[model samples]
Target: MSAPVVKGWCPGAHRPMMSGDGLVVRVRPRMARLTAEQVLGLCDAAQRHGNGRLDLTNRANLQLRGVSEQTHRQLLDDLANLDLLDPEPGLESRRNILVQPFYEHGDQTCRLTEILLDRLADLPELPAKFGFAIDTGSNRVLSENSADIRLETGMSGGLILRADGSQTGVCVSEERAIDAALGMARWFARHSSPELRRMRNLVRHTSLPGHWTGKPPGPLATRSEPGFTPKGPLVGAAFGQILALALDDLIRKSGARALRITPWRQILLEGGHSTPAPGFVTRPDDPLLTADACSGAPICPQAQAETQMIARQMAGRIGGSLHVSGCTKGCARQTAASVTLVGRNGRFDLVKRGRAGDEPAMRGLTPEDLLTLTDLT
Candidate 1:
């Protein structure tokens, strides 16, 4: 089989990347949230102009796939009408910020995010994938997510601006955090080359100022599960993929005033009740939560085999973290897993305790073979 191409750039609503099925248009909801009416409008557009699948991205964004070029204009129009589209493509692309899911309006996270959003135009020209994370909650939630700069609360309960790949950050007041972050961005822009596009990469090659290395961040956040939260009910979606119709039903049945996406493939139904909704994972221990898979076969041209179905079949049986990727690209899960199944020529190459691209211990395993395999753990 041919190798899968890795695209460094991410998709945006104005600049979507073409996929096997169609255009993959990404929607970066400000502060990682969407109101009920906005969500319903987006669902309508997804069903009418694109595939009915709404992808909850690891970056806490949403994507509508399978959009044809002919329908793309109409889809853009619909999104604009819903106030979802940013007219300036550059502004939309530059606003790649991730927020902790539980932020309230005018809170620290929201206020910092608003300041950053207002100043996006002031940011220096950098790589498309460069991003920021607002993790100022009592517990830092975006520690694992990708970001060039991070605004987080320190162990001493003071705000700090940290560069990714650094253990400590520079403490700053609420009013000056944005300026300090922008300073770090300027530093990155000056030091980074084509080979060093991300801040994490640049940080490793050069030393940060002595002042930016002493204030430790707050504790890591506890895992959020499917159940009740102060905001409302939390829910999960298998493979971070949700059907538009299922989401529509969930919103209507649960009466969710808003939806907040997370890096953990879960959603917070703000002001919503815990109601039984079909096609939404309401159990915290759902087997699918431990498994990861990407769109394979017909949906992804580079995929060698069908992925999601086999992933669903092997979830509970795998006994631990499993990553079933379409190809070596491992789009589903970049990190390590207990069992990594890499698709090749319509078969799976099994790699134990590694990533999808790692050397597989077994090759040419069929679906039936996987179903009957033992000793996965």
Candidate 2:
């Protein structure tokens, strides 16, 4: 099979990306959330305008796949009415921000994100995937998530503007936080080229200023698990793929006031009651929660093997973290896993405690071989 191409840019509602299935239209929820009505409406739109399934991206965005050209315009109108679409493509492209799900309304995270949204237009040219994290919560919850520029809390209890690869950050107050982030963005714009598109890549050779490299960040918060949270039930979508009908049913049955998207393959149903949904992972220990796989085979042209079924079979029986990628691109997960199965020539190559593209210990293993063998490590 041909290797998957890594598109430098991500899909936006205004600028959709074409995939094997159809158009991949992404929706960036304002503050990583959607009202109950908005959630229902999006579900309806997904059913009508695209494939009946929606994908929850690692960047805390929602995507509708399998969209046709004829329905694309109507889908945009639906998204606009829901207040999910930005006015123009440039605005949508620039607004790549991730917020911790636990932030309350009008809190530091909220305020900072609002300011950042307003100032997005003022920032210099950036890579298509260039992003920011307003992780100004009690602890740095977004530490595992991807972002070029981060506004996180310092160990000394203040905001710090940290580049992606920096060990430390310069502390700034609430008022000046966005300005500091913008300055760093301009720095990145100047230093980065087409090939060196990400901040982490640039920082490997170029050093951050002394001012932005002294203060350490605060301890990271524990990752949210699939279970009932004070806010609501945190449910996991297997492979970040949710059937629109099941989601619609879930919202209605759980009586959730709203839906909060997370970078993890989980959703926070704000004020939702605990209920066992058919397709959702409700228990914290559910094996599907830990299994990361991308849409493979016909859905994605680059896949050499069908990933979802084999991943489902391997989830519980495996010893540690598992990633079953369709190809080397590893879209479902960025980090290495204890057992990674990379698809090659309609078979599998196993990488233990390494990424998908890493060298495999075993090659040319069929699905039967993986299921029958005992040890993954």
Candidate 3:
């Protein structure tokens, strides 16, 4: 494990740092139509050259861990050979575009992703965290609208970008549609403060001018096709090492390698053309997705029990998004989940929020007795 660097407001600071001589590798395996075999090779490289661990980021990007002071150049050379390295320098961080992997190519949503990435790469001041999302004509993709910029298809045949409940211009042609989105992002970047990390923050101090307002085609909606829902199951890894190994095996067996590393401390592998083995998990209701724990004990000085070990034991019995933390730092997930088990010494405190079928409550319950009182089973 490496020492964590304390950073200020920049998005790059939030990501693991590389030395001046170190390389930041990007892989585009050309499997846009599906997840492919390159994912296995990438995982193997992480184990050998960089850190033995790999981070699955919230943006659906992967990070190789622990590149020593040496081997930096060799890593870059290897990644370039694999066509995984992005040609654009310093622009890699700005290309925070999210696309629905479940959708087919040539759709408006897919087109928007490509356009946004290209436009953003040309702008130097675009915040590293600045992101764009294309919801592939589906309800599941709409939840990803938390992105800085979001594009959705309207009930009519047009598309619109929504910012803070207001609709922007509607585009008849896919080219003009993406151009308008890029204009919006460029405008926001010019007016926002350096301290404003996301569009939501920029919108707080600024309002959408009349020049930017236009008629939205209509309410954006997605129609689900059979088996179009993101089918891969999210699984927790004890640490990045375990994650790398499991990822390697999955990629090797399925030849479907595209992966999404969620900020929630879980990895999502698109099933591609092949279905996983019978025992393989791929549903939201799976026990693995139900529980999460931080690196604790000896690995982290402030930790209590090996949270992952305890959480795995209790996974089947618990339901909802359950998290076990060594301390209050909450390095696991961004938001407080449905259930949280915070550790103190060797004892545990269970907290519950929201009803089974309702939106989870913002407040969390903290009581020792609740652990035995509730019928989580």
lDDT of 2 by residue, 1-377 (tens): 55678889898898898888999999999899999999999999999999888999999999999999899999999999999898878989999999999889999999999999998889999999999998988888999899999999999988888999888888899999999999999999999887789999999988887888888999898878988888999999999999999999999999999999999989999998988789988788888888899898878888888999999999988878899998999888889999999999899999999999999999999999999988788
lDDT of each: 0.91, 0.92, 0.54
- lDDT score, candidate 3, position 220: 36
Error of 1 at 168 (Å): 1.2
Q: What are the runs in model 3 whose C-alpha is more than 4 Å off?
A: 1-37, 138-142, 155-157, 164-173, 210-242, 255-280, 292-306, 325-331, 341-377
* C-alpha positional error of residue 106 in candidate 3 after TM-score superposition, expressed in Å: 2.9
Deviation of model 2 at 36, angstroms = 0.5
lDDT per residue (tens digit) for residues 1-377 in model 3? 22233233222312335533243333332222224445666676777776556654455556565565466567666666666665555665566666655555576666667666566555647755576666546343444333776666554545666553454534445667666667778787788776776777777778876654475534433422222235454444442324457666765665444654443334455664444533334454556654656655544555544567766666666656667666555555545566666555655545465222223222243333434444542
Count of clashing residue pairs in every prediction = 0, 0, 6
**Alpha-carbon runs more than 4 Å astray in model 2:** none
**C-alpha-based local distance difference test score of model 3:** 0.54
* Count of clashing pairs, candidate 1: 0
Give the 10-residue window scoring lowest on summed lDDT in candidate 2: 1-10
> In model 3, where is the ten-residue run with the lowest total lDDT?
354-363
Cα RMSDs of all predictions?
1.2, 1.0, 6.4
lDDT of 3 at 376: 46
Evaluate residue 339 in candidate 1 and report its C-alpha lDDT on the 0 to 100 scale: 97
TM-score of structure candidate 3: 0.70
